[model samples]
Structure formats: C-alpha cells, structure tokens
Target: MRRGVRTEEMQEQERSKSGLLLRGRLAKELGQHDEAAKLFGEAAALEEALAQAYAAQGISEQVWRHEFSAAGCWFQAGNFLRSLELCDKLMATPDAPETLRERARSYAQTLRERRDRLWTELLQSEHTLVAA
Candidate 1:
C-alpha cells in the first residue's frame, strides 16, 4: 500500500525528469544558454540514472546511448571536462557497438580541437590587449 504509493510517486518524478531533456533542447535552440545549461544538467542526471538502471539489467546498448546523450548534453551546457570524461568512458565501454565507440571518439576529437582553437583565440586577444 504505502510502498506502492511511493513507487508511483518515484515513477512520476522520473517521468518529469525525463521531460527536462526535451525542454533543454528547446532552450538551446532558442539560445537561452543559462536555462538550457540548467535543464541539460538536470536531464543529464536523469540520463545517468537511466544508464545505471540499464546496466543493472545488462542492457549495454541503452547504457551507452544514455551515456552518450548525457555527454552531449554536458557539452552543450559548457561542461567540457565532464563531457570529455563521459566520452572517454564510452570509448572504454567493453562490448559497446563500434558505431557508438567511433562516435564517441569523433566527439572527443572535435571537442579537443574546439578547445584548442578557443584557447588560441583567447591568447591572441590577450596579447592584443596587452600591446594596447
């Protein structure tokens, strides 16, 4: 009775959490950076929970998919380090689909390149400012 009620409530919470991912995407599309980041963070947490559940059930495909999604969301949220961490995890996941692993590798390379380019731009800007 009480346990059943609690389970229902928990399920409802999970459903609400899942909705954040879609909302985050919408916010991102709208260029609402702060809101998008917050929503994406919430959604990433839910994705992680889902990943754990899938792992418990021995569902490797779902686990990797959720992990990849969460990583992407973190990247969109400007959490590059976290995104890279998850990307590395995806790459290291044994028995994961080759396509997914390749995607993770590609994403990691892209992120690194983007970071390096941004760093160079920042340094160049700073040098110009110092010269002035």
Candidate 2:
C-alpha cells in the first residue's frame, strides 16, 4: 500500500511538471515572457521539491535528474545565476554521476557564453523594477 501510494504521488507530480513545462513554453511562444518566466519558476520549485523527496528515499539518480531539470527551468526563466548555481552544485558533487557532471559542465559553458546578454537583460529588468 505504501509503495502504491508513493508511485501514485510520483506519477501525479510528473504530470504536473509536464503541464507546467508545456504551459510555460506556450506562454513564451505567445510572447508572454513574464508569464512564461513565472511558470518556469514554478516548475523549477516543483522539480526541486521532487528532488528532495527522491533524496530522502536515497534515490541519487532521480535527485540529480530533477536538479538538472530545475536548472533548465531557471534558464528558461532567465534566472541565469540560479541556473548556474544548480549546474555548479551538480558539478561539485563528488558522488554525482559522471554523465550529470559532464552535462552540467557543458551547460555552465553555455551559460558563461550567454552571460553578457543575460546580464544586459537583467540590468534592463532592474531599471524597470526600480521605476515601478
């Protein structure tokens, strides 16, 4: 019974995660950037929570996978710093899977290359935030 319940919970969370990602993409495609960002952030939070649940169960692979997803969400939301943080966390983990570390390294490199453009966007948003 406990196992069944856990499976159900995981399935439900996966469904929700998928929905959020789809909705975020749609919003982005529709030019609703702020809405897309918010949706992506929500997706990231959900992924992080799921990662914690997996960690509590000693599911190392799932934990890193979820963290990788959360990083992607942060990237979609233009939260470069947060995305990079997750990538760094994965890369720094001695016990992390080799594939995960390699992926993170690749992602970190891309993030570095886009840093200037992302920084400009951040500065613009900052001004808008300050004005409002």
- For each candidate, C-alpha RMSD in Å? 5.2, 4.7
Q: Which tens-of-lDDT digit does each residue in 6-121 have in candidate 1?
A: 24544564686679977988898998989999998887777777777666666667778888988887887778898899999999977888899999999999998988898899
Top TM-score hit: 2
Q: How high is each candidate's TM-score? A: 0.79, 0.82
Candidate 2 — worst ten consecutive residues by lDDT sum?
1-10
- State the C-alpha lDDT per candidate: 0.81, 0.89
- In candidate 1, position 98 carries an lDDT of 86
Q: Write the per-residue lDDT of candidate 2 for residues 31-67, one digit (tens) a residue.
A: 9999999999999988988887777777788889999
Error of 2 at 120 (Å): 5.3
Q: Using lDDT as the measure, which candidate wins?
A: 2
For candidate 1, what is the lDDT?
A: 0.81
The parts of candidate 2 lying over 4 Å away from their true place are: 1-7, 120-132
